[model samples]
Target: MLDIIYKYQNLLANIDEYIEDSKFKKEYLIEQLGVSRATFYNKVKKKSFTIDEMVVLSTILFPEEAKAFEIKEALRQSREDSKAGKTRDHKDVMAEVRDKLRA
Candidate 1:
């Protein structure tokens, strides 16, 4: 759960960086994401977003950053799997994460 919370915060920070670097307004971003202002705010506040929603936002907002984010997420998941005593290949987990990111 803490990992998820951290991931959520990191994702938000990445979005903020993109917005700042590109001088892109949040309103425009929300529009591009097809999410209303209120809905966007609510999702951020609740930290409740589906992977598909996140992929859409990342792909639209900062495609380059999305690659970095996917790599980080894959690493984190791999660590978690190891911690849980799940015997799985890190490469396999990374492949799965990559597949999802591509989707």
Candidate 2:
């Protein structure tokens, strides 16, 4: 619990720096967020973005990190599914992939 709290605090503290260092333009972010420039700045200054908003911003600002996280999550879920005997045969999977590629 404390670790989670600390991580959240760290994110909030460094969000402005992240924005400044991001490759994305501020205008692009504002458009994507559907917020006025003033509103976006106010939220960043106050660290008052909601959890959903933070998720969106994080996904936008750190797409590679987000993708890696998703891949890790998928791997974890696949492991759990395999343990539960939810596995598909390799040959069948490859056949499906080939069919999709041909289409």
Candidate 3:
């Protein structure tokens, strides 16, 4: 959806600014990511982090925003699945949930 696209674009465009403005210390972030400081700086400068690295860093630096993005992405995917008739019936879903809760 447009919201997901807009958020993705904003994240891609402002990742560097986000890193710079994060409350976490760069050294701590580097340590948490298990990357050398130089490598971290290089990646930030080049915007060349791997998807795994980006996911970890984003979760650490912007937990709320990362969660929001994930929820939006899930909703978008759910909409697509619904349009494709890939969704289970609501009664079936509720039954499954109740079964799990009982277990």
Candidate 4:
């Protein structure tokens, strides 16, 4: 799966275009993300996104073609995450905290 994405990095670089233009008619991406078509559509329903989601999302949506600068930045970020002892997104973090608080 990753191999296929690497092969189509150029195309993925324009994922936003593909998604917007065809309403994410691209089945490969939908499948690769392990998300249902409804999940994709749900995101489309939103009018805005958190800045962080925008960053990782751009990369996830374009693993190959995510500009050299962005790819370098993301790599540096992942390294930083490793050094920090663990890695997870803000949404995951908040969910955990919220669950603990509820408990």
Clash list (residue pairs), candidate 2 = none
Off by over 4 Å in 4: 1-18, 21-25, 47-57, 60-67, 74-103
Q: Judged by lDDT, which candidate is best?
A: 2
lDDT for each residue of candidate 1 in 46-81, tens digit (9 for 90 to 100): 656567777777776677887888899999998999
Predicted candidate 2 versus true structure: per-residue lDDT over 1-103, tens digit per residue: 9999999889988999999999999888888888999999999899888888888899999899999999999999999999999999999999999999999
Mark the regions of model 2 whose C-alpha exceeds 4 Å error after superposition.
none
Estimate candidate 2's alpha-carbon lDDT, on a 0 to 1 scale: 0.92
Report the number of clashing residue pairs per model. 0, 0, 0, 0
Residue 98 of model 1 has an lDDT of: 100
What local lDDT score does residue 38 receive in model 1, on the 0 to 100 scale?
92
Residues 1-102, candidate 3: write the lDDT tens digits. 999778866776677898889898889888988999999988888878877887788898888988998999999999999999997988999999999999
Q: Which candidate is the best by TM-score?
A: 2
lDDT of each: 0.76, 0.92, 0.86, 0.61
Tens digits of lDDT, candidate 4, 23-97: 334465456555677775565465233345445455555456578768789899989989998777899999999
Q: What residue pairs are clashing in model 1?
A: none
- The RMSD (Cα, Å) of candidate 3 is 4.7
